[model samples]
Structures are given as structure tokens and as C-alpha cells.
Target: MSEKIIFAGTPDFAAEHLKALIEAKYNIIAVYTQPDRPSGRGHKLTPSPVKSLALEHNIPVFTPVNFKEEADKAQFESLQADLAVVVAYGLILPERILNAPRLGCINVHGSLLPQWRGAAPIQRALLSGQDKTGVTIMQIVKELDAGDMLYKKEIEITTQDTSGTLFERLASCGAQALVEAMPKILAQELVPQKQDSALVTYAQKLSKDESPLNFNHSAKQLSLQVRGLNPWPVATTTFDEVVYKVFLAQELSAEQVALLGKIDDLENGAIVQVSSEGITVKCAEGCLLLQTIQAPGKGRVSAGDFARSKKDLFVRGKCFA
Candidate 1:
């Protein structure tokens, strides 16, 4: 309990672990988060979720741009921490900083290691339509996420789980996993297993080019896109040059597919129906119901509301193209 812990992280997911450590009475001596950057309509600087929580606890906080400078590494070394706990910390710690702590560094990674070893694991899992994914506690090496696995906890990935919702679950799961693994790690009771290079899969950072939904894919695949991209570079489709963010969607069932055929001229991306339920669009293999959406420059609204407000734009046979 008296161990000097240094926490490094930047997002809400990381904050959850920091919170658990605080609640569990871990001696967190300092928190290192990314520097505040411009955000929102006003473009005003804002503290990260992890930084905000650390400050509230009166823990010493540091926001260095990077550990490229020797002085920055020295400042970290000055902490004399027994362990460094990292979770979604945007900056990569140099080997010098990683070794500063007496116990070296460990991370609460979002996905099962030897897999999803990069910036966007949660999103990648959903986007790939994986049935399940989990958290990995691993030693932090210089190689990006290529570390010895300390512990792991798996969770099911449901059809309804969006990246945002999955993020919430993973945050809680990662926090619990980290708290449970910490003591074992310090006691040296936990054995570290080297990651299998053969099974490694990289979770590359998402890009804006991946934002637009491609109806040429199957409804199920498109549905995954809708869920995977929610809350960042969100899945979108343009009609009349107006981008509509698809927040919620579902694939058509067999019965629902039977209900089609009323519109023979329909093509992929064609508006199938605009009912109070949602806006149904035809995909290459099936139909997808857009349940929630955000119109251009507007707040999120039910797909029905969007359709009702623009009846002609959503009429049957009108293509998303």
C-alpha cells in the first residue's frame, strides 16, 4: 500500500483505472497525462479525463509533450516510483522513462495481447465483428505493446455493443483487471508470458477516410461500421452533400427481408422505407435500419424524426448517392 505509483494515461478509460487505484488505496504519487489541447465549439483548451481526476485527488500532475528531452526523463526519474501504471497514455515513454520506476512499467491494454496491440483496439474489435474481446495486463517494453502478458480477462462482444458502449465496459473491465493484477505483480507471484509474434495483429489508428459507410458491403458489415465508428470519425453517408452521422443501426431479419420486394427498382444505398421505427436502407446483401442519426449541423435525433422532417429526401427509391 505504501508503494510509490506513477500513473500515466489520458482518456476516460484510463481515468477509470486511476479511480479504482485511488479507491483501492494505492499510493499514486504522480499522474502523467497529455498536455491540454483545443477542443469543442470554442476551441478552448481542456484537461483530459485522467488529468482532471488526478488533480481532484490532489495528486501531483505532469503534462509533458514527450519524453524526448533528457530533463523530461529526469523529472520522471525524480518520482522514484516503485511502479508505473499506464493505460491509453497518448505519448510513448522512452526506454529511459520506462526503466525509471523500481518495478518498471505495466499497462492495462484494451484487447487480448498478441492481438489488438495498438491505438484503437476496442474500435477495431467491433469493426471486425469479433464475437469477444478482453483486457490484457502486460509489462511495458520499448516495442509498441509487444510486452510480456501479466494477466487477462475476457468479455463477450454483443451485437448491440457500439465502440462507445464497449469502451464503457472495457474501462470498467480494465480497471478491475489492473487492480486485481497489481498486488500479484509487486509480490512477483504473477508469471509473465511472452507474446506470440505469430498471433500478433495490429490495431491501426482510425482515419477520416473510413468515416463514410459503404453500402456495397453486407448489411451486417455495415451495421458493424455503424457501431464501430460511433463517437469518433463516425460512420456517415451523404445525401445532397449533407453528411448524416449514423449513431444506431441494425441488420434486417429474415422476416423483414420477406417484407421487402415492394420496391423492385431499389439498389444498394437506396432508401427502403421511412417509418416511425427508423429509416431502412438497402444494402448489397440485406437491409439496415438506421435507428439514430445526426443531421448536418444538428444534434442527435431519432432516425424517424430525421425522416419526418425531410420526407421527400427519404422517399423510397431515393439513393444515398
Candidate 2:
């Protein structure tokens, strides 16, 4: 028999998992997602992806402003759910709600836990230059992502993987892992191991003010930062007192490094030269080749186009703030 599950989630990533569960024929009794909030440039209020998916499946959805309220808690417990699945739910589940389900709550986290255990796992992993990271299905406890692992799947960190890309892959992988873990979870055959508190690392939520690219960091570190923050709050820097976003970049190749010799020792964001490939800029420890960039009030363009558009900005000794 399928377990009577209560699903809770908010973003598209979470919705993917919910869809997988529903497609697998799980008896989803209800869904709980955060209340709608203003979004997009127009700031229109829209239902969360999870809510939309639940509505399509003919499952009831609850958008509680306060989970602690008597009505909200009563409504949740009334489902008498056998289990609860949560992914990026945005709202905290109190002890009563956590223990209400017969099999307790399970969460799909985007990082290898005991590390990056908070609001921005995907971004943190990429920013830290982690060569490998992946999803972890765990038994949810009261603490933040401090749960026992039920399943995990690792993925390689390619030189080009951004937080946005990594998130999509992890979300899909998590859905598969969650579906497979459900059977063991229902049969009571899964073992829950305790996480080591001493080794914990937190992934604090990112903010718009954090997008400025610091050239004082090493080439690899700066590159990772740019990639992690891309597509939202993208890394920005000032050139000729005008802010420009670094859309794509990488460490300079040996050929380009030879061409940029000696001049590469200049201060941060100093454009050494523009070769056939791209423009070389000095970083704290090495050099970065700007592949794509966007000038203030302009759309993104290749380094060659940007250099051509603003010749003075790409001069040999000019530094970007």
C-alpha cells in the first residue's frame, strides 16, 4: 500500500520532487507551501510552484501564514498523514508538526551534509570551489539541515557548473533518490546516523549587496564566486567608475599567460592586454580572462565586443575597481 504522505515545498526545485512522488503513485494527502509573495519586476503575487503542482494533482494545498496557529496545526494533523516530505519549504515546522506524521519528516538537502547546511547550499558549494558535492536525503529534525542521512548521490563539479545549473541537476537527482528511499523508509529498514556537530558549516542566505567581485582574492576563488552568483546577484565590478557585471570568465591559459607576462603582476582587475581569445585581468594570485561582460545600462556581450565598444576601458594599464 502507498504511504499517505503530506508534501511541503515552495520553489520549482521542491515542486520537481513533489511531481516525482505523485507520478510514482504515492498517496499525497496534502501539500503545504509558503504563502505567495511579490515576485518579478512587476512584483505580482503568484502561487508557489508546489502549490500549482498540488492543485493540478487535485490535492489540497495549505498556505499558512503561521504554522504555529491552532487552525493551521489542527488542519495539518487532521490529515493523519503517514509521512511528510519537505524540500525548500521556507517555513519552519514546529515539533508538533514534525512528530505528527507516523514516519516523521524527511528532507531533501542540496549538499553533502555536516557542511553547507543552511539556506544557500548550492551557491556555497560552487563559491567554495568544491570539486564534488551532491544531494542528501535525510530524516528531518528540529535543527537546520542537521539530520541523519538516509541517501546521498555525489556529482562532479565541472569548471563551468554554476549554482543555477547545479541546482537543477541536484533537484532532479534528489527526486529520484527520494522516490527510491521511500520504500525503505516505509518498511522501517532505513538507518539514521547522527551528524557530527563539530564539523558543521552553514550556508547563509545570499543578498544583493554581496554581488561585488573582490579582485583581492585568487583567480580560482574569484572565478568560483562569479560562477556561483551568476544569473542572480551576479558578480559586479567598477570600470572607469561605471559598474559592469562579469557574466563569464576563467583562468588564463598558458599561451595567454605568456603574452601577459610581467604585466600580470599589476593590481586587481588590471587589464593586461586583449589577445585573440579574450582580455587578461590580474587577480590576487593569478590572472582571469574575461569571456563575457555587461557594461552599465547595456546587455551582456563578449569581451571582444565590450573591448571594442569602450576602447579606453581595455587599455593596457587600466584597472577595474
Top model number, lDDT: 1
Q: Native-vs-model 2 lDDT?
A: 0.86
User: How much is 173 displaced in model 1, in angstroms?
Assistant: 0.4
Q: Which segments of candidate 2 are over 4 A away from where they belong?
A: none
All candidates: TM-score: 0.95, 0.95
Cα deviation at 119, candidate 1, in Å, is: 1.3
Cα lDDT listed for each candidate = 0.91, 0.86
Error of 1 at 143 (Å): 0.8
Q: Report clash pairs, candidate 2.
A: none
Question: Cα lDDT for residue 26, model 2?
Answer: 92
Scored by lDDT, model 1 comes in at 0.91
| lDDT for residue 241 in candidate 1, whole number 0-100 | 78
Residue pairs clashing, model 1: none
